[model samples]
Target: MTEIKFYRVNDAYGYLSNFAPYPFEINGLIWSTSEHYFQAQKFLDKAIQEKIRRLKSPMDAALEGRNRENPLRSDWEVVKDDIMRLAVFEKFCQNPAIRRELLATGHATLIEHTKNDNYWADNGDGTGKNMLGIILMETRKRLKAE
Candidate 1:
């Protein structure tokens, strides 16, 4: 049951853009669990595990091409989106206007999100002081307040 549920969640995340391992939520005491985080981790684990499994087979390359083209797969999609987002930001960083606009707007993501790197670094660190999407949302809030 776990595996089946994991696959469904993984496929959806893989197919959808702006998808992550989790989204934010508030609950009792101003803290709580979210469905996005649960679903994202489930697939992230499977993608890593499956990559290991494929490495054991010499014909994995031939199989990989076909697997990526199939809509049933999310592994390629996730990788593609990350690469594409970084690529766009890298190009944008080269533009003076975009960089100036980003900084002037005071979007907290103006630094990290606009960077070509550090966008996808994940760690098993114990510190969980903040949620992933907090910065951009907060930026929006500040803009509205102004």
Candidate 2:
């Protein structure tokens, strides 16, 4: 499902705006802006991607432990746990208003990309980090642009 959200912050940390107290409910109804719409979309996509990469790292580590006799089976379990971890991460890191939307979507979507590589290709964060970094980066860009 395509996400639609609007953000109005006086300051990234704290600024000033004509917006009133209840911002989340603003919801493109009473007010809306396209720049915010695009930034939110980009930031959300980046955040979810980062979350997937971060979650898959431990699974990779689990598979690498050949010293453990039954590594393959252990790795499979790790893969399952990795997915749950990403869900928790996404729920915790996502905005409160969107949390329900995310949770109700795919509960067990596999990670298509990781920090290591995927489908014989290396297309990932490459640098391990949580979704915070992406949110912060996009927040900075959005704040600066406005």
Candidate 3:
């Protein structure tokens, strides 16, 4: 198998605008998207071993306030190092068992949702940004090529 170079997105602004990972379904509940996945794995779960310690919240004011130099940085930084260090997408894509489940029923078509859902990834036409869609598709293609 050819080596798959996973491209980690810039979380400098919360979820990376153009390269976020798509949501995958596990069990019956949907994971929503990669943002939620990162939060759950890298941010929320304390038991999960990570180089960067998880923050109390993504928008924890105290943490944000400490970084006066770059207030513009995404609140996701708390767990950013962990994600980057782990090369999360690469790990996520490599798992054949989980990948099979996600590919079988996960919603890869939709990117953007309604405004009430916070207009996430919307292209302003009710269509999702599909950022994760593009990344995952490319990953799948590369994985197949190998």
Using TM-score as the measure, the top candidate is 3
Ranking by lDDT: 3, 1, 2
What C-alpha lDDT values do all the predictions have?
A: 0.30, 0.29, 0.38
Q: Candidate 1 — which residues are off by over 4 angstroms?
A: 1-74, 108-146
TM-score of every candidate: 0.24, 0.18, 0.35
What is the lDDT for 46 in model 1? 51
* Deviation (Å) of 46 in candidate 1: 27
What's model 2's lDDT at 137?
Answer: 31
lDDT (10s digit) by residue, model 2, range 116-140: 4332112354233323223323333
**Which segments of candidate 2 are over 4 A away from where they belong?**
1-115, 119-146
Position 94, candidate 3: lDDT: 45
- Candidate 2 achieves a global lDDT of 0.29
Global lDDT of model 1: 0.30
True-vs-predicted CA distance for residue 30, candidate 3, Å: 22
| TM-score attained by model 3 | 0.35
Top-scoring candidate (lDDT): 3
